[model samples]
Target chain A: MQHLLATHPRRRLFQLSPPATKPSREGVFFLPSIRIGLAVLALGGLGAGSLALAQEPPAPSPERSRELIRMVRQDCGSCHGLTLRGGLGSPLLPETLRDKPPDGLKHTILLGRPGTAMPPWKTFLNEAEADWIVAQLLRGFPEESK
Target chain B: MRKALRAWCWAILAFLPLLAWSAEPTLRGTGDLGVIIERSAGRVLIVSTSSNSIISKVEGLGDLSHASVVFSRDARYAYVFGRDGGLSKVDILRGTLEKRIVQGGNSIGGAISQNGRLVAVANYEPGGLKVFTADTLEPVADIPAAYGDNKLSKVVGIADLPGDRFIYSLFDADQIWIADLRDPKAPKVEKFSNIGKAPYDGLVTPDSRHYMAGLFGEDGIALLDTWQPEQGVKRILANYGRGEEKLPVYKMPHLRGWAVAGHQVYLPAIGRHEVLVADTIHWKETARIAVRGQPVFVVARPDGRQVWVNFAFPDNGFVQVIDTLSGKIVQTLEPGKAVLHLEFTPRGETVWASARDDHKVLIYDTASFAKLAELPADSPSGIFFTSRAHRIGF
Candidate 1:
């Protein structure tokens, strides 16, 4: 169980400012799916962070894949802009990040490279969750477009 | 403990999709000084000055998505205007919603009359200006017009003057209509060709001599001398393009405003992190103060001594306070989530803000400009004070 920790409006507002948009989508501020998951992790407890990693939509099961699409729209919609079209981050669809392997995707999620707004989620997620998130990216939300 | 963590992860996986499906991106507008407004909790919020960790929130106002707030002539009452077509007259001194009257119809904004005896609300549904006796809050009249061919025919801004005096803008039609209210019961209206664009936001001077409307596409704000409608209107200044062209990489031209105060006008350049200040007296470009991120709103202090600007960038949503005289950003407050609209107390002592990212209205102390408390707001657009003039039995 997670303790109800009181959130300080000033501190987090200053430190964890949400990126307005994705710098990649032709300068439109859009958020990627993984980033949306990471933002939710920040709002959750230490266990929730791991939970986010584990629940990283696009489960091996079909039911989970449907949910992954929802996560991309809702959780990632804040800084990513609505529609998951990509704002401040690169496009997640295969066409956008083509030729990249799952390990490459996992590496980016786990050890988020420096010199970029991306943050390392190694501490927040276990290996399983990272892989699951990668699976959805590979499959793309078109499989479950609303 | 490890087992417990594992189980929790399992549970989260089950509900992750549902949770993500409902979350929405927060919207904020930077106003006058260091003020911001957004939908948080369930009320309209206002945070003034920068030093606050939390902003003061006014609850039970309305949906932030379809509502807006404006000040009375005296800046004593903040009229919370909503889409259900209602206005929540709030008393800033008493910290309460004085009264809630069904006002406006998909209206652009609300205005108080010159004598403060009556209040007028613009509604989009029926596309007309609704007048109410300020004191009784009774529907006095439904001023109709030939709305033209506007697809979104909501009255955008309103200014009350002398001689059956009132002026309002229609968004879809891109026109400004003047109504002579010398006799509140029967008024005469004359519509003019819009100087620039539609959906313009403007303010009437304290003396009610002129109305200044800010255009979105035009490079600057426009002025209409309401004193004599027959003399026609004057385009005070236009083509206020972004001054910086040296760094093609960094140069951007912007000329637009969300709100105006006294003789000073404040607006944001979408391409830059700064708000431009214009002097209504000289009617010339005055100054531009750099802000943190994306600026959406600008509002002025009651006394017009200070102007605050808020940002929209997640981290860029800090508040910047400017000394009106010098036109320089003097203090910067890191209130989370760029602000949209903010309001000041009667005495101008406290500042309240609405935050979208933080999901709450954070209040701050004006003295030290520090955060004090947080109030739950649904979608606080902008903060406004109650009408000191309304209390006199309007």
Candidate 2:
């Protein structure tokens, strides 16, 4: 059964990278030094001290991430085009979703809009997973890689 | 020596027609040909159902992730409605795309008129129904599904009715419209509003008399009798959720497949794991047969003896066949992963199922429940046979 997480925001500072250290209770496993460097590179003027205080939610295993990508590509592609350019459903492309808040998008993914054809994915995905999906959709969802 | 060589050549020429006739005497018929949509690859595999083999692959049709196909009246050409709004006319015998045009920004599906003179496309992006001539793919008429302060509604479940008419439902508008294209130049439309909430998809009965649209927001199906339009739309199986908290749907159930066996019609119940069987005489609910997962395509065989079902997302791997005679699950076969679509032979002797993850179309004997053959494909989704050319609202 899929689990749902609370809507509390967990700031994911960097991209999905293999951690050199053991995972923590908060699910932040990447090396602090590397995380800080990448965060600085990504956020431009963000300070390392503030980044250190940011918490990251537990990330899906690499295997599960692959499954999510395939699901988004094929299953979600049924309505949203395989390219995320949209068909019966609205476009999930980065350019279209960039103006939308990531949290709102995550909620939409978890709990679908009531009157629309977009069905809720919460039955098969959790809040963290939905959050990751929204982040990916904002940064351009990855292609299905076998 | 030259005269002797010329005599031998003349003898060979005299028997050339006989040799050719002996090799392939019968003319090729389009009846045994079919097309399979390879979703992610933007290509379609033209296959021969008689040999259960892939004839050729036609490529460059854009963004086929949600593509659907309709056959020409002659069954020689397949008109593919791509999600990217690319309308392509492909000649199956020649294994080539005869013509293609981006009729809209995003399209859901389309249908061919009764006379086969026009093709109507249901678009989502521009929110309208665009009709074109089948021969040249030229624009004939454009009908915008406009509602409420000049806003356009997405058109879904567009199917051709008898007498050169086209029927479709508007998703956002909760309405069904029938366009009379008897004269392709000037089309007349009749509309029925407030039928139900979110008519996701629709289908016409095998006899081409009734058009039913599946409601997404509500628990019923909005059905219209084409023969009696003055009666308006009627709701069947309303509030089927039974006052219980409904389960979240992973994928929207499809109503495009007409599964009317004898007098009973099989429809997938939204947010439920059962196929609701209803009587066609009065359109009343008869029974609900529990099945695996949310039913996607509850399609009946050509003869309407057995109804085949595939599920959504997680339960998509298994396919169940229902014996219409007894209303029981006759066989449950795990064909492969992500079985997106299924199509039966023109005679209903064999059924072909596409496994997107497995990258192959599995052919099964509908009677003996045995595997017949397998053909390779790239993320195959919808398997359409040219036999659809003769059927109404295919």
Interface RMSD of 1: 14.4
> Model 1, retained fraction of real contacts?
0.00
- For residues B295-368, could you state the per-residue lDDT of candidate 1 as single tens digits? 65565666677766675434335777878778777888876653544566555567677664455566766667
| TM-scores for all predictions | 0.56, 0.86
> lDDT (CA) for every model shown?
0.53, 0.84
List fnat per candidate, in order. 0.00, 0.72
lDDT of 2 by residue, B1-394 (tens): 9999999999999999998898874568899999999988899999998899998999999879879999999999999998878999999988899999989877869999988999999988678899999999999999999998898998999999998999999999999999989987889999999999989999999999999999988999999999999999999889888898776677787887668988999999888889999999988899999999889999999889999999988899999999998999999999999998989999899999999999999999999989999999999999999989998998
Best by TM-score: 2
DockQ (0 to 1) for model 1: 0.02
- Compute the DockQ of candidate 2: 0.34
Worst 10-residue lDDT window, candidate 2 chain B: B19-28
Q: For every candidate, how close is chain A to the native chain A in TM-score?
A: 0.45, 0.62
RMSD of 1: 18.3
Which portions of model 1 show Cα errors greater than 4 Å? Answer: A1-146, B1-66, B69-79, B87-105, B135-138, B145-152, B162-164, B242-264, B270-272, B313-316, B365-367, B372-379, B387-394
Superposed Cα deviation of residue B269, candidate 2 (Å): 0.4
